[model samples]
Target chain A: MLRLHGIVGDRRDHALHHRLHHLEHHDAIEFLFVPEADLGRRRLRALTDRGTECAVSLDRDDALYDGAVLFIDDDRAVVVRAGAPRELRLRPQGTEGALKLGFLAGHLHWRVRFEGTDLCVVLDGAAADYTARIAPLLDDGIVTVVGNAN
Target chain B: MNAPALSPATPAKTAPAARVGIGGPVGSGKTALVERLIAAFAARKVDLAVITNDLVTHEDAERVRRSGLIDPARVSAVEAGACPHTVIREDPTLNIEAADDLERRFPGVELILIESGGDNLASTFSRDLTDFWIFVIDVAGGDDIPRKRGPGVLKCDLLVINKADLAPHVGVDLDGMIAEARRVRAGRPVIVTNCRRSEGIDAVADHLEREVLFRT
Candidate 1:
């Protein structure tokens, strides 16, 4: 039974490095990847299949990139995964359309992006189901498409 | 019914430099205000350095560095990675590190101005990032801005209405806008400024000197 706590970067000065190296050499292992959005303010994340929980306490400013490993043990390890990218593509008809869309995304705490004439929001899961949620908030001329970018 | 008595703690250590934040919507005169502040603070012989956050480019920081108002070395730019608000509010570590580096390089610096990447009404600085902050909005943005009562407008230490000269051209009554701003703020101070002519700048400088810098 291993209790994982904090990111490797957060515990660089601790003796856990030696333990992690020794654990990595073991063959019997289970890997779990937690999506970035799910890794919110919670210090403990429950891994259902493993029937165990890992505590992730990265520094306040540390960014969890795609595929960031959070824990490593003799039998299991937890990873931070960005998951599939779903974006809301918007087309505004009026002069203020682009600005309004950008503002609305930021106001709603969504990460905004622009590719040529289209404004995009990397969808925040069910919390920001923009197709079912945000499209109605815009004026008539604005068009919204929610799907894979590629 | 009485409030608990306060306890006096150990003597506090003097802080390094004072940090001020400037934030507002795009095209709202945030960079202009920074330029004006640089000159004004320099004229008063205040030691100053600046950190700028740009959404995807270093254009704003480059403009200030090229302005000849202060040494180019005194300005540093942090890319917001397109999430401007997060860099200033949610996770200000990048900005904190930048400011710490600036202070380390210029030990005599008494002030550091952090300019946020152009953002919307909800944008604000984290308390951990700035000692005081000013939210700038312009007449061209429409007088309804204050009436909207966005967090930046309602919660900033000071609110500045810039481009006062454009009020007439934009069909906005400057007096009505200022009146509504005051009403929404519950009588907090609002300064009207035409940064182009440097009107009402001294008042802003005076406020910072007295309130933030404690000059006199």
Candidate 2:
């Protein structure tokens, strides 16, 4: 990712940076989901607006937090949403279940938090559909709805 | 090739000072190591300067400056602005600028040591910013640290297990810890040190002279 390189300074990269800067003010808003672990990492992203795609370079030593505005101007701003781009919630049976769920969440690069005995996971939407196959690996933890996130 | 008339008369850029990064978790003896290095390098007469990064304060820089080991003027402080690792790895522009400034102020400085703000094992220095880096961890932090095999432990140019004299007091198996570190690094250099007693420091200096400074 270009942003992972630190700063976008070359003329070509500068032009794209300015273009994205302009898009930040337009009515068409795009969502960039930032995982908790990636909050402090440097990276580049590509965004599309009405079939036109452009690169957005985040080149500063900046930390991305949930609800932090990624881009802003007088008219509108693009904000960050916390959690995985997709997610799943599971109700674990006990301590072993919690450990299994935690291990799976880490292995899958899913951000997870516990609500009492319930495991709330933020991960890929596709993985949520595999609830039938995943439950057996989690020490009999039951799968819940896939889309719910905070 | 035809060039502008002014280009031919322009002075060529000088070589920048070699930069070394010191990074480790909080309370891991990074500052202590820096203090020792200051004295060691000074005795060798290596023209050097230092840069210290702190989260919100210049405490580490102040400490080094007040230690009287090196000139206070040679030490610079950088505030990491809450993202400690980001300043060193993700975007090292600020540190680069500081190192450049040091080179400017103390012309002919051969080396610059950049001390990162105390952070977790995930922290590392950007190669673009540092020519070489040393990761310092202590025996008191527990032997499991090597088993964890964080990127810092595996990737640092040199790994320093500091506070070795405390191994007996802390119930750490010194040889076992060093053995695991060697295993994880696959024979990369790992140095055991007791900064408090100034033990095993010459080896570090020798490694830097050969590896970083190419001094033989």
Interface RMSD (Å), every candidate: 20.0, 17.2
Candidate 2: residue A92 lDDT (0-100): 60
Alpha-carbon TM-score of each model against the true structure: 0.57, 0.56
Q: Tell me the DockQ of each model, to 2 decimals.
A: 0.01, 0.01
True contacts kept of each: 0.00, 0.00
lDDT of 2 by residue, A33-122 (tens): 655644543332433221222223232334455554444334333445555555466766556665766666555444455666666654
Per-candidate RMSD vs. true structure?
A: 18.3, 15.4
TM-score of chain B of each: 0.93, 0.92
On a 0 to 1 DockQ scale, where is model 1?
A: 0.01
Docking class of 2: incorrect
Candidate 2, B61-149: lDDT as tens digits: 99999999999999999999977899999999899899989987999987889999999988888866776789999999998888899
Q: Once superposed on the true structure, which residue ranges of model 2 sit more than 4 Å away at CA?
A: A1-150, B1-14
